[model samples]
Target chain A: MLIKYSVKTALTGLITNKSRSILTILGIVIAIAAIVLIVSIGQGAKDLILQQIQGLGSKTIVVIPGREPEGPSDFVNVFLDSLKEKDYKLLKNKNNVPGAEDIMPLVISSVKLSYFDETYQATILGGGDDEINNLMARIFDIFPDRGSFFTPQDVSSRASVIVIGDNVREELFGESINPLGEKIKINGRNFRVIGILPSKGQVSFFNFDDMVLAPYTTAQQYILGRKYFDRIIVVAKSEKVIARTVSDIEITLRSSHGITDPDKDDFFVETQADLVERVGFITNILTLFLVTIAAISLLVGGIGIMNIMLVSVTERTKEIGLRKAVGATNKDILRQFLLESVLLTAIGGIVGIALGVALSFVVSLILTYSLGLNWEFTFPLSAAALGLGVSAAVGLVFGIYPARQAAKKTPIDALRYE
Target chain B: MHLIEVKDLEKTYYIDSVQTPALRGVSFKIKEGEFVAIVGPSGSGKSTLLHVLGFLDRHTAGEYHFDGKTINDYSEEEIARVRNKEMGFIFQTFNLLPRTTVLENVKLPLLYSGVKESLWEKKARQVIDSVGLSHRLHHESSQLSGGEIQRVAIARALVNNPRIIFADEPTGNLDSKSGKVIMELIQKLNNDGHTVILITHETYTAKHAERLIRLSDGAIKEDAPVDHRLVAADHFTK
Candidate 1:
């Protein structure tokens, strides 16, 4: 028989029991939909994080005060205070690191700030004088919406002037009150708020809206009461020189800390590109895991298809006999049943792709509008293609036994079947 | 050569290693363009004889030749092709596919034949018109009467222009009046030079054909020409 008639016959067979066909394909629909949703959302998250990491500028590199962690147990080494003021001063010298544009040492700690009657717990970020502070602002792309950052004189005098984030201002001083020049108590010491940052939610793993910035000298002398630095931020002169600058900073830190062996180095440097690669790897792994979980449902769906096809073959025994008597070969019968199943799963795949995309778009909308994250709606075309292929494969894998059973029937026996 | 020749054809049914014979040492020959009826009561093995002749089942021991080729001479695929191109069937139950249009049902044989798709509708319509059912082309089988359903089956059998048609009690499911109409249609087809094989238990129905082979106890008891064969054109006014 020609393939066209076989397809038409298969279509007629499916259409005769429209409700049963729909119910049989539901498992395939749900499985494909779940796979598409997971892959799309995972792509969206990866894009958002990569975009934020890139926003930190390609020339910017972070020098964390710990060795590169090789395992879970080594994670504790990240919190060790290995970077100090002398290492910072050595990295500042042009003779020591020629490609370094600016170096800023950061000391971060969570602290409570108080006004007359209000108290708000916020992250405290302490950094160097004006030039280094400006570099930090340039990297974060954030500046004061009200007052200005502290000057060089504040670092030299250890003056207790501070820059408060937008959330701190809202908590201690309501919208009606100007928080600039207000004396906020930190660690039982009075500090004048010189700047109020604009409300920026999350950027490069930090929520700038819930932070307070001050000169590093004041934070170390009075608030934190520690002499070691937490992190050192380095800005390379250009993207082309970032690799050379990373090695330069590594060598400088090692020399200053008297570390000759490369493996014994106490500091680790990460460029923007490295962060993007790591984030992409993690998201891909997570998406693959979820897709694997969704494939289980597809297996179940294939079994459902097999079950329904067996029932259909048995129910149409008389029809099969009639067709054979009219000269349809066993191969023709097999092709007809196989085509019916493949058509069923292909339709399910199409509906699933549409449903998954719509659901992902709705979720992205909620994430963007309600939660204020930069979430983009991504359509995973490769995943859609993979879904379609897998669904068809499922049909073939599960449909063979029933189709063979149908083709194996003798015309006389089938006609005599009740 | 005879169109069909059978010698010592035997069929045995094995149920759990217990052998019960269905066709025992049957011999017959049918020429081209001849209308023959095989008559027998229930359990007389006439149905089994029809099944073996129609290639719907295999005989255990036989020398059966159809169109100059033995049953074993053709492969499975070639047998299906021969059936599609040279033979047609009409069941006692009028096995028209349910929920399908009359036109589609009539076109069923042509689907498996070597006929071109562009000519299927034209051939189907011509046969349906021969059975006087052109007006009900698009009606589904469920909407058809028993007689009309049998006519559609007849149309399907003729659609591929086969050399022989096997009608297994074609009018068995219809009323006497409808049965007369179907018999008239089958007589007209045989008169038009298509070979017809009719299976029936009634002697009156057997007399409609030119020749009769009476079967009893899995073997042929009589083979003779009908003296007073019914001429459907003279009996029924159109």
Candidate 2:
């Protein structure tokens, strides 16, 4: 009952000093807003990366033809030709690896594409006809914007046909000219353009807008003269069979390479789940760093609350005396002042959370619509709840000193205070 | 039994190892329902004695009793309880909380007294009505006139039905006209069977009580019943 009265009195005190209360609470508002915005943005970023990775089909596993590159020093393994065509054939056969639904072999290298006087350096990706049918058309939203992709007959006969990205097409042929049915030279050999790919700005560090696609057999034998595949993408038959497909590829590759020792394997396999975990780990660290910086401001805000509360107690000495003279115990005075500070911080916290959420929405909009980032709007309920709890804790921790000072006053001296 | 008893009450102040006495071995008694005035010059310790009597301060060496029970033996919490239930104070400044409604000011004491929650607002309203402030119940104390503020203080003092009301120069800050009204209100409380301990320096204000105790230099110089009560009309010309 007394607590209820104390809260009422505390509110009265705050109302009496309207501007001071607002200014005091401003500190907490900024601090809490920073916390909420940072945490929400962090959560949004993590979700965006995870969603992008999942967008490429969660049932697909990527097999890179090298040891797992742990650092920049180990990136040299990406250029090593360890996996052979026999390994791809073995992984593709359903009898040998029943868990595999389909496989697309890829070989990519930087090459210059020329159309008479106009020339542009672009990544030329070599893939089978099944790649455009399965990986490109399904995983990425890569349907031909004009003409059509090379056919299975072209892949089997090593046809000199190429499909160019929108950027490459725009560079070789002007906006008015049609690149379809035209011939482009790759490494001094002429290859007819069979398709023009739709533009995809950037995905997972690879700029699909700046690449060209050609048949793997034609690129290996006629262009680069390389016989090894760069990477293999295997789609599992079903979501439930993804783990089985990973183990099946590992077992088949292990026997195909004549490798018995697990550590000495010349290839690395990664599923969508692994990439999601890695992304989550990275975003968690970023969130923690931002929150730590935000917490410092909250601490400063708590200190401001403490300072104001102390000043309030000092200024209201006679008022304290009047209360004590009217039968208020030390505890009552203490609780009154304490309640005032806690209420201040709590109100500040609630306003901050609201402002943070609004700010997060603005930020997400800017990221998605303005910057074209794959950002999602997310309100982390746990962070909002934590903000409230931390605010109350700040009030409790910083408010106690001034409250104790208020409570310790002797009624005689306090009453005498001018 | 006497409502308040004092024996050789002494209050000494120490500042930087200097001992200055505010109350020097004084003694007094006040019976229930008595309208007693303690009149003294500045530094006479009348306020200190009242503070000690009201349990606002601890006496440094004294035997004190209220209702025949030893007051000095009670803990601070117990004294606070007694003050909440049985004692009320009116300051010279009419120390009502600023920016608060008159009714909230009167309800302040009961808020600390552990009174029934349902009785607080009703009881405060009743006391406010008694002081002819029913219309001003919602007025902020800071906005009230000196006379109205004093009346509100009186209402606050009387809200809990305290056994005794201590008015320390209740009209010290008011004009003679407002001061007279405050004095009559306090006098009316006494006439209505409430014990009143009036502390004042002004002769005219002290004259409202039936008995007067004069003090000088931290000691009681005189204590006796008044032979003739001084009237406010006759004394106001000076």
Candidate 3:
């Protein structure tokens, strides 16, 4: 019976001071909304990173030369031709890396391709002839739309033949013209187009639809002449042995490069699983940092609640006296005020969650429309639950001082108060 | 046995290092179902004595007994329990909750009385009707007149069926007409077998009670029975 009375009284108290209650609850609302938004956006970024890594195919391992680029300045390390041809040969030997099924080396450069009078700037990719065909078609899912890729004999002979992407074909030869078996000029030299590639849109923020592919030996020997590979993609025999293959490639490359110190190795090897784990770790830290900053606001919100409750206690002194005179115990008065503050924060928390969900939808829409990013909308259930739990804890923690002050008022003094 | 017994009751007030005695060595007792008045000028400690009697304040020195049991050693919790079950208070200001309806104000005590939920509103309505404010059951205390507010307070004091009602200047804030009506109501309650201890400075209000105890300088000056004017006038017509 007392509990029922207390609840009714608490509700009446809130209604009696509507504007003050709303302002106090608004503090909690902003704090909880910030928490939900941070966690949701963090989860979205993690998903995007994982999706990018997955697009590389789980069975593939990547090798980069010149010490793994750890920071923005280290990106220049891609220009260092530390991984020589001998290192690639040693890694491809079955006895050295038994877990490897196939290896494909890649070299990329920007060049102008011309078909008769029209010309367009395009990224030129150089890879082994048949290896490029099988790797692009099977692993990357890129296949020629109208014609077949060149043969291994073409790569051995350093043939001046090229396969053009969908956008490159359209740009140089126009959509009406079939570019297969047409002759294109590369570095002012005549080169024949052997195939046309279907568009693969964009993967990992790079557009594969605006590039041309040629035999690695042909590009290395003739156009923008270079003898070193930029990056290598290795297909593991199976998922179970991917880790073993990573270590084996590291040892074989280090030995071929004549490196004795592990730390001084010129190349870095990474599997798809390792990339996924690294992305997840970075995103988790970002989430934690954002949440910690938001929690400071929650602390201030709790303090605001306490300030309002203290004013309420002072305003209701006469009522407290009356209640005490009519047989209400100190415990009853304490419980009444505590219930009111908890109700305030709990309701604030629920409203914050709804607002956060709506905000996340707007964020995802902006990402998709303006930036053309495939952003996913997520409402993590644990975040909502945590928001509610934290709000309740804040209410209890901040409400106690004011509530105890109310309970401590003696009936005679309270009744005498103006 | 006396319904109330007091032996040299004393209460002292301390402000900073100063000791001010509000009540000094007052003694009195009353039988069951009696209507008694404690009258005095302001600062004569009549209100202080009433508060101590109602268990709203503690006595600095005293031995008090109610219904043959000593209450001098009762803890604050024990006193609160006894007040809930046995004591009711009617304040001079008609201290009904300003935001609540008349019925809700009257039912406040029953919320602590352990009454069944189904009977709370019923009992509250019955007492409100007896006080003749049944028509204003749903009206907030702020919306009520002074007379109606005091009547609601009386109904609240009666809702728990307390053994004794401590009314500290119950009509001090009302007009003379309303004050007379409140005095008559208290007389009727006493006649209906309810113990009432009224505290006031007005002699005319005390005249309605069967007995009077006058205080001066924190001590009782006179303790005697008076010819109750209302009861006497009714007797003469009969």
Best by lDDT: 1
Residues A1-418, model 2: lDDT tens digits = 2777888888988888789888988888998899899999999988877776777778879898888878536656743687778988899888777987778777888998899999999998887654345344555557677888777777878899988888998898979888888999888889999888888776654567798888888888888898888888888889898888888899999999989998888998999888898889889988999999999999999999999999999999999998888888888888898899999999899999999999999999999998988788988788889888888789889999999999999988898998
Between the candidate structures 1 and 2, which one is better when assessed by DockQ?
A: 1
Error of 3 at A62 (Å): 1.6
Residue A130 alpha-carbon offset, candidate 3, angstroms: 3.9
Tell me the interface RMSD of every candidate, in Å.
0.9, 1.3, 1.4
lDDT of 1 by residue, A66-171 (tens): 8788853666675378888898889899988899887888899999999988999999988866444465566578889888988777887888999888889999
Which pairs clash (backbone N, Cα, C closer than 3 Å) in model 1? Answer: none
- Deviating ranges (above 4 Å) for candidate 1: A72-74, A93-99, A128-133, A238-240, B234-238
**What C-alpha lDDT, on a 0 to 100 scale, does residue A103 get in candidate 1?**
80
TM-score of 3: 0.89
> Which should have the higher DockQ, number 2 or number 3?
2
Per-residue CA lDDT of candidate 2, range B12-70, in tens? 98899999999999998899999999999998999999998998988898788888888
Q: Give the root-mean-square deviation of each candidate in angstroms.
A: 2.5, 3.3, 3.6
Best by DockQ: 1
DockQ of each: 0.75, 0.67, 0.63
Model 3 chain A: worst 10 consecutive residues (lDDT sum): A129-138
- Candidate 3, residue A233: lDDT: 77
Residue A181, model 1: Cα distance from true site in angstroms: 1.8
